[model samples]
Target: MEHTQDNGSVVYPDVKTDYHGHPNYFRVLIYLLVLLGLSLAVFEFNLPANVAIAIVFAVAVWKIGMVIRNFMHLRYEPILIWIAVFAAVFILLAFFWGVFPDVSMVHRELAPKL
Candidate 1:
C-alpha cells in the first residue's frame, strides 16, 4: 500500500520507464542485434534459396518470441494472454493456408492479350 507523506507526496510502488538503467534490457538488445546479424549473415553461406528462406523464417520466429517475451513485457503476463496470442496466430495461419492452394494453383489464363 502507498501512503501520502505529511508533505503531500505519494510514494509509489515499482515503476518501469523506458527500460533505462536496466542491464538486462541492454543485454536483450545486444542479443537481438546478434540475431539480426546472424539473419543477415545467412546470405553468405550460399545455401539453396528455399533453405535460406526457411532459416530466415525460423530465426524471425525466434526473434519475435524473444521481443515479445522480453521487450513487450509479455513474459510476466498471464497464461490467457499467451493463449489469445496463439489463437490469433492460428486463425491467421488457417486463413492463409486455406487460400494458398487456390492462389498458387491455376491451370487457365483468364484472358489473352488483344
Candidate 2:
C-alpha cells in the first residue's frame, strides 16, 4: 500500500509490518530445540561415525529449513524467490566442489627435500 502526503511524495509501507499472519515463534523455537537435542543425541549414543555424521547432517538441514520457512518468512515468498535462493546455494556448492580438490591435495603434497 502507498500513501500520498501533502507534499505529494509517495510513501510505501514497510513489508515486515504488512504481514497477514505470523507463525508461532514459540512453537518454532521448540521445534529448533528438539532438533538440537536430536543432533546432540547422535553424539551421546555413540553410533558409528558414518551413522552419526549422517544423522547430524540431516538434523542440521531440517533445522535450517524450519528457521528459513518460519523465522525468515520464506514460506510466504513467491516460487521465483525460492528458485533464486536454491540457485545461489547450488552455485556455492559448485564453488566448494571446484576448490575441494586443490584444498584436499594441499595437505598431502610434501615439500621437496633440501
* lDDT of each candidate versus the true structure: 0.77, 0.83
Q: What TM-scores do the predictions have?
A: 0.72, 0.70
Give the poorly placed runs of model 2, Cα more than 4 Å off.
1-16, 101-107, 110-114
Give the per-residue lDDT of model 1 (tens digit) for 1-114.
Answer: 353534566665454533212226777888889999989999899999999999999989999988888778777567998899999999999999998887678545743445
**Model 1: how large is the Cα RMSD against the reference?**
8.0
- The residue ranges of model 1 lying beyond 4 angstroms of the native Cα positions read 1-23, 108-114
Whole-structure CA lDDT of model 1: 0.77
Candidate 2 colliding pairs, count: 0
Question: In model 2, which residue pairs have backbone atoms overlapping below 3 Å?
Answer: none
Top candidate by lDDT: 2
